[model samples]
Target: MSSERGETVAPDWPHPSLGNDLTPRVAAALAAAIDVPDFGTDVDATLAWAVATGADVATAPLAEAWQLLASTAFVDVGAARIIEPHLDALRILAEAQRDGVAADLSSLGADESSMWGVFAAEGSGMRLTARTSPGGWTISGTKPWCSLATSLTHALVTAWIDDDTRGLFAISLRGPDVVCHEGPWHARGLSQVVSAPIDLDGTRAVPVGGPGWYLSRRGFAEGGVSVAAAWWGAACALLVPLRHAARTERADQIALLHLGEVDAAMWSARASLMAAAEEFSHDGGDTLVASRVRTIVAHAAEQALRSSDHALGPAPLVGDAAHARRVADLGLYLRQHHGERDTARIGRDLVRGPASW
Candidate 1:
């Protein structure tokens, strides 16, 4: 990675933190663990290391947490994919606790070994609803995009509280009433992280927040930005082979040109992430800023992918497992940005009112 002064830095270089004391230690731990031979393949080991880091987004500086996430993604996109959701779930619960929402880890089936996920995607003609019963709250219906639902111990699901209102609930996926359906998930990227629909038959749930609270919270935007950080990290990882190709075997002007383009895109994206982290640390979450960061990073990631393909060709994709996985995982992950639809929405928002630059 290139600094603002045009000097090179290691991929695991620690970004400046907002007075967070744990930042350096966290960076060192991640840098040390990421080089392990088995860390990428063992999700449990990665998760355990992540949990041990004790980096809480709610308590620590948001930049610190985002940097941690980005560093994890830089080494292993699959590991980052697994770690991100679990951390997000913890943040959601923390927010719930801070808001005086009635929730307890034990009631949510969270334990020392519990793996958490968030399931909020709604499908057409399929509705998941939470209804009040004498026995407490129960959720029934099919929830789409429940990643790792079969293997996860618990999840935070968003379901319709009423006709037009949605609320967040924590439920145990291990219950007899909860069923993880087979098939439907066939993606090459992040192949280990299976995302499929889950069927629930009156599964017991504990509400984390009130109706509309899940989407309305500031943390929601912050969470979106966190995904962008992961995207940025994967983009950075793609440059590793590019840099190697540039160093080991010099090439013509065309390869150098593509390398420069990739570098410019990734450098700008990294700068954007750091700037966004500073803003989030102070001003909290602004939907517009978060959207802009995600959109900008998404564009940069796409550019990096394109330029890398043009420069290195098919050797890295076929010869290297980590490089190939990062390429595919990043391509798939960037789709969460919603492309032109989100871009148009941002443009319309800018046109409608006052903007923050």
Candidate 2:
């Protein structure tokens, strides 16, 4: 993709400064770590580093958002993804404490740094079920798309309370009743994430929020936007090869055109996310804004992937380590975002018009 190192030098656009206290150093550290090509291979050590520097467990849920951004930019989505729900669980725990739900949160963040994946998808199929008696609650069933299921210390899962309702629960992943089925996953990209369907046989569980309330939690939309930020990071990262390719004459004129277009898409995605961030601060957990930004960024990511693939052809896809990983990683991660369905959902929400918040 490059013209022999110094054939023509590109004026690389700086990765986002984010202009937040946590992001500057965290981004720098992440940028440095990306150079290693396999920095997140050790999930625990990487998490420890993230916690030591950027993640403040005490002020969490959203406090670590910027750090998540930094890590995502560096293609550490698997690690960052695992940490996301743990922080959310802590936030939910805080809410539970305020609501007088009597459960112990003392076990968290004490023994070891935890990587938690949230298993909250309520889609039909082999769904998880919860049963309660005088003894306590027990959960049993399957959860799909469980990222880092085997590696994470814990999970916040969603299960059926009845035919019409669902509830969120916090549970340890290592329990004897829990079975993490690793064989079913066959993803080429983000295989590092280790997503698998979990089968639980009466695993003891602690409810995180009341039935039907998990999706309405304050951080639900915000956490989604945070994930959008991560996907946007991978989207932004896909451009380095394109940028470098654009700098030289040997790079085909057609290739240069593709790079320019992809750059625009990246910029547009960033701009939309910045708008959503503003909305988040003012309105608080605006699902409308979250969906809007996620769709816009995912659109950009789709365009970038297509343009880059057409522009660069096959060499970088297989030969360039960083470029290859970024393409595959961003491609797969962005799938976590639903394109037209989300766009329509937002459109449906707009029946009252933009005049109403």
TM-score of each: 0.89, 0.84
| Candidate number achieving the greatest TM-score relative to the actual structure | 1
lDDT of 1: 0.77
lDDT of 2: 0.67
lDDT per residue as tens, model 1, 151-211 = 6788899999899899999999988899997557788987777888999999999888888
Could you give the C-alpha RMSD of every candidate to the true structure, in order shown?
A: 4.5, 4.2
lDDT of 2 by residue, 223-304 (tens): 6777777776666665767777777778877878888898788778777776666666666677887888788878888998
Q: Of the candidates shown, which would achieve the greatest lDDT relative to the real structure?
A: 1
Q: What is the C-alpha lDDT of each candidate?
A: 0.77, 0.67
Candidate 2: lDDT of 64?
A: 45
